[model samples]
Target: MTELTGYQHGLVLGKFYPPHAGHHHLVRTAKERCARLTVLVCAASVESVPLADRVRWMREVHPDVTVVGAVDDVPMDLGDPDIWDAHMAVFRSAVPERVDAVFSSEAYGAELGRRFGAASECVDPGRTAYPVSATAVRKDPVGCWEFLSPPVRAALTRRVVVVGAESTGTTTLARALAEHYRRRGGIWASTGCVPEYGREFSEEKLAELRRARPWAHWSEVTFGTDDFPLIAQRQNELEERAARLGSPVLFCDTDSFATTVWHERYLGGRNPRVEEIADRVDHQLWLLTDHTGVPFEDDGLRDGEELRPWMTDRFRAELTRTGRRFLTMSGPPATRLAAAVEAVDDLLGRGWDFAPPLPERR
Candidate 1:
């Protein structure tokens, strides 16, 4: 290892379960005191948040700090001597550079500093400075939203999924809500929407199939239960990607649950994997767009103009059956959009307080 000349290097280590304002302040404090700082993000397999995600959050806040992940499958136990030794080795390996000082906000810094032959500097040991903990943040992320960064906030944001049958304007309302929140500024500047992945995939398939066979029609494309699992997975992937991009409140065009409904209708029953994915997706609200006399245009893929009411009822039945929170929407596009915007605003306003009868679901 290369030895530095005169500059003093500091080491700050923590699980950073999800880096919050308290951790941010601790890192900033260390940076101000030392010429160079290296933050060791220790992650265990049993942690709720992934190691890669925690490292990303640390880097986002303190880019200049030498952020490194100390990933280990070993259980974390400060009480056991063997556990401490394993952790110390993990830390040392992560940062080979000689640590001139150890910075932390806990009593453990002293012992860790001794192992490195460095001074232990505790910042805000009393927790009075930031008055928060990782445990508190985990319990209620929204309650502690003010202290969290954009990436973390986005992860914790509640999703309001828009679902409907043909010509019910799910995409229109989704786009409108996304745009409104994004332009509204403040924390919502990070808000955006996940476009329907199923439609995009179908469009691509149509183009490719049509080029190969001139007689190919949209209805000719037979979709099986297997196709929907990929669709559901892709939809979630897009939603998660949007959230990382800073969209705290994502307006989803459709979610896995709605896809499951389609699966049941077309394939006789929902695929096991699709059902599992749907069950796992955490949606705060399901905005069901009603077919209120809207003229259905031939979208090529949608031979489902006749399938509107049936599909809509199927969607409603699924929501009701699963005991999921939902709101029923009817009227002109503008009216539906207005209602959706209002519901979302209320949803955000109350910090995701859903006491039912918000907009009334059929």
Candidate 2:
């Protein structure tokens, strides 16, 4: 997360049960002024199906936005005033606190920003483009959800998420492949994988020690799992999105599978989640990279490479235990990315229509 300044940040809110053109222009304009934009989707429920639907719909339209949970720290009750205030607080807390400005359509948002000491404005979609909204869409579900913003419609088609461990080129390959998919033009985004929690240990002495065995806490629910919750949560969210739109949705940088791998290797066995995911997944492409050539570099959370071998082995073993075959790219970074692009092409060719997504910001 970076500091927000110079009036470039804005908050776009909506259920997005079905995205449309007006939503597109507003997001597009906001991105132009802000280095980053955050979208706050109003979910109708927390049940897996509804949540998944929203996430999937959003993924289709705003492919690059860092989609996150809004109800996590607050109640999802739309009618509860205390809960409503709490909801705003939760989003405000999770949101990049330092934003230059806020974007909204609701009347209260302007006043809300003023009370909070943020510069805010309501961008009038009615004046700029087709202003059809959820109300009209609800009145006609088939017609409305069908006609969505180019970005939104494109975002909804199908998703591609790349998964791997730290130092592996998941992020790099994700972006490259995303762009490669975009050239074919439908909707695609290289969603970056989640950050590792191990790096968060701030105890200088304990951190330096690297935790003897590191397996003790692997099964502790309180302690982060050998199979991290982020992966499960990520899957849970994506599944909800797919179920919501009644369409196939994809997410990259999964946690549970990656977690299952680590836990199995640590415990010298398999985690059931890994087994379920192998056949459960529509497709899985694992990138095997030897961190030997790459020097240990801590990008904020990734602290050291002493454990790189341990992490790599767990990922590999998990792939094997599940009988999941992966693509191994052992060489320079560029070579790996090239191979990944080709492999993805082969996979998508199996059934993907392969439409180039909307044009990304230059």
Q: How would you encode candidate 1's per-residue C-alpha lDDT over 1-362 as one tens digit per residue?
A: 12432338988998887789999999998887778899998876666677898898889878888889977655655567787787778888999879988988987788889888888888998888888888777665656767888778666787899999977888888888888888977767767788989889889888888899987999777777789999898988888777766545888999888888878767787688998888776789999998868789787888878889999999998899999889998888788888888888788666533222112112
Q: What is the TM-score of each candidate against the true structure?
A: 0.70, 0.41
Q: Worst 10-residue stretch by lDDT in candidate 1? A: 353-362
Candidate 2 positional error at 53, Å: 14
- Regions of candidate 2 where Cα sits further than 4 Å from its true position: 1-161, 187-222, 238-251, 262-281, 352-362
Give candidate 1's whole-model lDDT.
Answer: 0.81
Determine which window of 10 residues in candidate 2 has minimal summed lDDT.
Answer: 353-362
Highest lDDT scorer: 1
> Deviation in angstroms for 308 in model 2?
1.5
Supply every candidate's count of residue pairs whose N, Cα or C atoms clash at under 3 angstroms: 1, 26
lDDT of each: 0.81, 0.52
Q: State residue 84's C-alpha deviation in candidate 2, in Å.
A: 55
